[model samples]
Target chain A: MVKRLSVLDANRCTGCQSCMFACSRRFGVGGLAYSAIHVRSVGGIEHGFVVIVCRACPDPPCAKVCPVDALKVRVGGGVILDAAKCIGCGFCAKSCPYGAIFWNERENKPNICVYCGYCAGYCPHEVIALEELG
Target chain B: MDEYLKNILYIDLSRKRFWVEDRGSLFEEYLGGVGVASKILLEECPKNADPLGPENVIVFAVGPLNGLFPLASKTVACFKSPLTKSYGESHAGGRSAIAIRQAGYGAIVIKGASETPVYVAVHGKNIIFRNASALWGLRNSITVGRVLREIEGGAGVRTIMRIGVAGENLVSYASVNTETYRHFGRLGLGAVFGSKKLKAVIVSGKTMISVSNVKRYRELYDKIYTTSIKSSVMKKYHDLGTASNIIPLNTIHALPTKNLRESSFEYAENISGERLAEKYLGRRVACAHCPIACIHLAALREPYVTEPYFYKTTMISYDHELLYALGSMIGVKDTEGVLKLIDEVEKWGVDAMMTGTVLAWMTEAYERGIVGENEILGLKLEWGSVESYTKAIEYIVKGVNEFYKTASKGLDALTSRYGGEEFSLSYGGNGMPGYHTGPGAHLTYLTGARHSHLDSAGYSLDQETLKGKQLSEKEIAEKLYHEESWRQILSSLVVCFFSRGIYTPETVCETLDILGYSFNEVELKRLGEKILSNKNDFKEREGFNMLNQRFPKRIFETPTPFGLLEEKTLYESVKEFYKILKERARNS
Candidate 1:
């Protein structure tokens, strides 16, 4: 069994960005420079918000786009970054259909969610959660 | 001071130049947001500068708590108001504060006038003045937003603030719409933007802020977050949004209706929050870092007459202010009717309260035979008629004729040109708020720096009176002064006022302590007072004489929740407020 983060319903998203803050706060600071999960309006906010994150594919396209074999597959459905091996091409950022791979501009590296489920806890509306896969 | 908190970005639109200056001591003294913005406004704006001229300054500032704490989620915009022709300030909640803070700037001051329309895109260390001549004549604010959303990046994190045709035409109460829902909705910020030919402002950033103490920081964050989620008041706010006040206010005879001819509405039940939520509540949104999702949008479906088979659904945001201003004030009884009117106002990006209040005045003037069909462009202005009102709103934005153009100038210009001075509802030259609570509400409108009801929240004082507590004029003035002065602290920290109950002085000190800033409760109080006096300094410097505007006669005519208001009581209260303000100004 493997655990993964999931957006239970984007319709419940309020655009508070608490989940984003929580994701970034895992780095022990309050700023949002390193958040993997993101939520954006579908054109305009009146239309409502859509939560974007890695859907955890069986074989992620981000791994294939990695020229340096920096992204290694985790046991579940996502890839884990090997920071030392990454050449910082940002191909993984463009390759991800969800645009979930956030970038670190200073270091030129990708920030991948570690399936910590920390963000799900901060979502006041129950819009996201952690689930187990069989 | 933190290095990032000291950076101020200055842009001159006339020269198309931009620069960053470090002002650590200013932020250290003032804290940021309203405090810093107000200080900058006083320094940058010339004496008797035209509100729409190149000399006027526009300051967008975020506080230290933004991007680091929950509900510290507002950007304070300080400028000279075209509407009041005096000191102007408005607070907007969206990603604005967070974006500005993250973008490596404490504040952004925009000066000078552009020959052609432009929108400034600001990010970390880069400010791009993009030509926006094409977007100048866009049909609506939403269209302008849609066009800019494609040109600018940072979809999730950035804030795009833009104005509509009303702003382009220098409507006195034009609003700067942000994120399609929230706005700098009062005091003519949009008009200021128009004067400078600034169509929009885009801000987003990539930055990391490390805390002084990570463990203590997380603890405080948890306390604040949990406290917000569990509070019943927050629950009420989240469920119904601010529209929850409609039924209660009507029942208490505090809801202003029919241009405040009556305090209560006959059809209040139809436009009540409960009804609107049950029928048309489409979505609930929140500002960045706010746990409470108080922004409510109603799904309004309209069918094209040519093709009745297909209907388009437009999402319109609503609150008690819009409910009272556009709904009850103008006599619109039904929920959908109010939504339609709000849609029109939102499209034009004018202050909805000002627009509705303006229409309400015109409606009464037309009915009184003060203005005939010729004055109203041959359209019969009727109360509660959304069709007529929508057309009137379009005319206001289009400046179709003399009356339509004068309509956007607000009550002063309108009353001066036309008769109906007695029934004209305004407070200190600005359109009146929806409250007819009592003298406290009236005093806040008159004596508060910006003439905003939120300045001291005197309605809260009126609620105490409703509970059968008798207070004297001096007591009321003292209370208003204390509360308003204290609120300067919250605004300086830039926290949402909704969480005032939760963020006590002790809690505030704890949060600040973890941020490497230490202040005792007494010191914090003094800081708040100092900041407030600075705002008053700006107001006085701009030559706004509070005694100039008298209360409209309709206030005494209409029976309020407190019965017919006594003119003597209001006069005495205003005098007391002035005395307090004078003493404070002298001491400062």
Candidate 2:
């Protein structure tokens, strides 16, 4: 069994961007440039938000689309980015179906969610969660 | 070099030329946002520059804490006001501050008028001026935002600010709608934009800011985050947004209803926060870097008159000020009516507060036979009539006749011609905010630098007085001056005022310390005072005389929750305020 971050109910999201901040803080930096998780309004915020985070697929599309084999599939799920081998080309970000892959434009690297569930901790509305998957 | 405050973008709309200058010294002294912007306005703008002329400058400034901390979400816009014809400052909480900071600029100074309409796009260091001939005269601001969103990339970390027909026509109280829900909603920033022939500004970037002490930063971040989420002080804002104040203010009879003829509205319950949340609350939203989602949007569904099955759902943001101004002040009792009025104001890109106050005055004038039906364009002007008010808004933006043209200038100009000076309710040429709390509210409006309620928040003082606290006029003046001075520090941090409790002087110093800028409590307070003095100096230089303001007789006529505001007490408070300002000037 492995714990995975999940969007329980995205309609409860207030578009607070707390999860995005938490994701950025994991890198000891501020701003949304390097956040693994992303939240955006559906056209306008009145329609609610679309919370995009890696769903921890067994065979991640982001890992499959990597040009230089920089992204390696984890044991449980999700993918780990090997920054050394990466070409800084944004193919993985484009290939991710859920739009979960975040690009660090400053470094030209893909910031992937490693199923750490750090972002879920900051969601006050219980819009996201970390649960065991068997 | 300060990492975030590195570049100041200077855009000359007339020449279509743009350059980035290193403004490290400006940010180092003023620390950004209003502090930096006020200095820029003073330096660039001519002494008596026409607010709607090429001589006027528009400054968009973000602070040091902007991309580095939570709730540091406001971008301050400083300019010569077309409304006040003096020092103008307004703030909007959206992605604007973060986008500007990330876009690698401390401040953006826009000067000179463009020969034709245009929108500037700043994607990191790239500044592109696109012709906005088509965007000009757009009926709805939301459409302008939508069109820009498609044209401009940077989906997540970008802010699109646009104005509508009200701004295009140079309505004196027009606003610049940021993102959709948030706005620089006072003193006619949109009219300033219009004067420049600028329709929109799109800012987006991906820049990482470095923190000096990562460990300590995380600890303080966690502490602030925990406090913001768990603290009861922020709970009310999170739940019902600022509209939570409606019930409490109404209960205390402080809510100005129907042009301040009454202290409270009879149907306050209909438009109450509790009712709105229960019935119409579509969703809550937050500005970038803010954990508290205080922006409340109501879902308004309207069926097409021609098509039986066709319907349109619109999202309208509401708050305490909007509730008071558009809801109670204009005598709108229905929640739907209030939402509709707010939506119209949003679509037109006009300041809701000023629009409501102007309409309230007009309604009163019509009832008194001061302005006849002919002047009202054959439409009956009555309180609680949302349809009539809506039509008036249309006429105002259209500016077709003499009455509409005069009305577009604001209540000051309208009353100056129409013989309703007694109940004009404009302080320093800007229409009044919702609060008719007491002498404190009135005095702040008269003496505060920007003539904004947020300048001093005298309503809080009035509430404290209602709790059996007695204070002299001098004490009230001192408290106001101190609070407003402290707010300079807050606004420099570019933090939202709602989170003032979280960002105390000590906490502010700590946050700054993390960013490698050291300032103790004493140093911070001194800096606050300095900033206040600079703002007041700018205001004074612009011909704002504290003694010269005409007190509206209507405020004294109406009895507030505390009681009728005394003219002598208000005058004493103003005198005290001036004395403090003079003393501070001498000391500095």
Candidate 3:
């Protein structure tokens, strides 16, 4: 079974950024600095929100663009960054169509979702969920 | 203190310069948010400075707990009010608090006026002042937000507080709109921004915080998160939002109707929270870091005149205050009319409560012949005429005539020129918020530091009075003073009022203690008292005399759950509260 976080319904998102905090909390203290998932308003908040996260594409463009073999394919469809082999070129971040590649400006490294589903637990509105796809 | 909270960002619009100062000592004693802001307002603003002048200061602050705890999500803005011409403070919940905290500052003190229209962007240590002359007289505040959203770098984390046409024209009660659904909604912050030629302040940052004790923090976090979702108070706030209060307040004959001429509306049920939820409730939203998504937006759909299929749906945020002011107070019976009026004010970026109050006073004055068709500038204002009221809202921004211009100044200014002082329902110079419970609400309106219902729960005290335990004036005064003093702690923590019940005195102490701030419940209470007295010091310094407050005659005419209030009782209580405050200032 492969498990990953997904936005069950964008309409249910209140744009509270709770999931962002939760995602960040996994790396350190509760904060938005380390978040991989994001919920931005569609033009304005009155229109609602757009939840952006890595959808775990099987043929990922982010991996294809990487000059060095820094991003290794996971058991499922997502890729995990090997920080030791990686250079801070930012090509992976620029190549993602969903804009899911989050950058750590302080370290100049890309922070991609680990598919841990930690953020799903903190979404108060049940707008997100961890799904098991077999 | 958290090391990040020690930095205070000082921005000078006149020189287009910025600096950072570490005010660690201030955080040690006064804490952050309102406590620090009140003192800063005193220092930066000149004595009795013009509220809309360049000398007036804007202090936006968050507490030590902000960006660290749940529901610690509000940014406190303190300034000299053009509306009240006294100590002014307003709070808003959005990404503002989080952004400011992550930007590595406890407070941002803005002084001096920009000669040209501009919007300030603060990205952590980065600061940019961009020219915004093109955005200056935009018809809708929503459009301004849309424009900023496209150009701004921080998509999810940033908060853009922009004013609209009403603000650009210096409507005294104009609001600072945030996140479309939220606002710093009272006491003329927008007018101050307009006077400075400041269009918007966009703030965003991404910084990691370190925790002292991981397990304890996690345990406490889970407790607060669970309590916020499970508590009945939070449930009500979540389920229907605050509009649920309409039915209950109307049942108790406490809902202000038609400018308080009637305590309850005959068509109360027609526009109640239940009615809106059933018909037009579109979606729910929340401020940053808050679990209780209490903000309810209504989707109103209207067809084009020529084509039935060509329709547009507009999303408008609604709460009890907006409903009371635009619905019952202005005599709009249907939900559609109320939503339309609410939407109209939202577009203009004026304080919805003040705008609604102004419209109500205008309608009453017109009916009484105090102001004729000539004074109102050719429009016939009726009780439920949404069309005419909509026209008046535009006139407030356009300044079509003398009467609409005066209306923009507020009820206090309106009643002075016209002869309807007795019917005007403002306290000090600020317009009255929803709630007509009795003496407690009236006392709160008159005595609260910012003259807001939220300064203390006088409405809660009305429950005691309703139960027939008649409180003495001293008892009433002491109870209110104590409650208000305690709330100073909450505001200093920068916690949302909805989470106050969850953050009890002990819990607050514990939370602070965990953050390396050692304090017992008693010490915390003492700190709360000191912070409150500091606010009063600013109010009194700016010529806000508690002794000079006048009760509107309309309050006595209307009956509430606590029955018709005795003016003498409220007067003595105000006096006793004055004595209590004086004694504290002396002791301090």
TM-score of chain B of each: 0.98, 0.99, 0.99
Q: Positional deviation of B316 in candidate 3, in angstroms? A: 0.4
lDDT of 3 by residue, B317-418 (tens): 999999999999999988889999899999999998888888888999999999998888878798978999999999997888888888899999999999
**Worst window of 10 by summed lDDT in candidate 1 chain B:** B540-549
Q: For residues B242-335, write the lDDT of model 1, one tens digit per residue.
A: 8888888888999999999999999988888899899999999999999899999999988989985899999999998998889999999888
Please give the C-alpha DockQ score of model 2: 0.70
Model 2, B171: alpha-carbon shift in Å? 0.4
Mark the 10 consecutive residues where model 3 chain A has the least summed lDDT. Answer: A24-33
**Model 3 bad stretches (over 4 Å):** none
lDDT ranking, best first: 1, 3, 2
The sequence of per-residue lDDT tens digits that candidate 1 reaches over residues A48-119 is 888987877788999998999999998867888899999999999999988889998757799888888999
Segments in model 2 whose C-alpha atoms lie over 4 Å from true places: B307-310
With a 3 Å backbone cut-off (N, CA, C), the pairs that clash in candidate 3 are none
